[model samples]
Target: MSSAAYERIRNNPKFDKLVATRSRFAWTLSAVVLILYYGFMAVVAFNPTLLASPLGEGRIATIGWPIAALMMLLFWVMTGLYVHRANGKFDEINAELIKEATKEAQ
Candidate 1:
């Protein structure tokens, strides 16, 4: 694409909104993952016994195992969520922005 096209898109409010929305979403997801993982680590560091406790009277596995698994699953789910939103909403807006930019340039 030409510099003019790039400049046109860069100046578009839709382009700015796309960047802002994507950045906010990515940061939010990162914060959630950090909080969850760090919180888990903090618990393990400060209160190891809590995470070490068995799931039930006779169970061998600790509760932490499942919680950790869930955290991992959460990361995957968040990834999918971003991908879905990017493909559906963000991409649509981006295409529209490009079309507008091209029209404006022409």
Candidate 2:
């Protein structure tokens, strides 16, 4: 709550590790989603017929439909993965840092 406590947390090595690890994970997930989305868009832009084509000889659905759905599901899974790690490992490290800082402040 105090500035000194904040400074103490900021100066902690665990705090730096937490920030670096979380940022790296977030960026990695972001890059994966971006690549998937943009790659799909590129396909749609350059090869519309490929995506537009039907899934099978008699199927009404296009191949792109399943691909898009899978991409959406994958994104959700990635989100869950991030949340799991954040709530687990990240939170543990954060709690430790906070407790340490508070103790040092006292």
Candidate 3:
């Protein structure tokens, strides 16, 4: 195995810290989203009748429809949050690592 590159970055405290923090946030966020989604689905599954009933008069929507819509919205928001963090923070770290590696090679 060649160790010509990444030697300095491997020992960089900043890079290691950034990676640890990013990984922690990424995993925690993913778990929270999964738990929420499954929990909601489980609730609906156990109580199928809850969504079947209409919220109010004929004009009102079904209870389940709104809940599903809210879940979708929440998922979309979570996706956006993940993208924002990945692009802003994670990618920045990656770019720095690459820049330092290339500089060291030259």
- Highest TM-score scorer: 2
Backbone clash numbers for all candidates listed: 0, 0, 0
Q: Would you estimate the TM-scores of all the predictions? A: 0.90, 0.91, 0.77
Tens-digit lDDT track for model 2 on 12-101? 999999999999999999999999999999999999899989999998999999999999999999999999999999999999999999
The per-model lDDT (C-alpha) reads 0.93, 0.96, 0.82
Candidate 2 accuracy as lDDT: 0.96
Q: Report residue 66 deviation for candidate 1 (angstroms).
A: 0.3
What candidate 2 gets wrong by more than 4 Å, as runs, is 57-60
Per-residue lDDT of model 1, residues 1-106, tens digit only: 6999999888888888899999999999999999999999999999999988999999999999999999999999999999999899999999999899888866
In model 3, how large is the Cα lDDT of residue 95? Answer: 88
27, model 3: CA deviation in Å?
A: 1.3
Q: Write the per-residue lDDT of candidate 3 for residues 1-106, one digit (tens) a residue.
A: 2376667778767788888988888898889889988987887889888778898888557788888888789878888998999899788988888788668777
What TM-score should be assigned to candidate 3?
Answer: 0.77
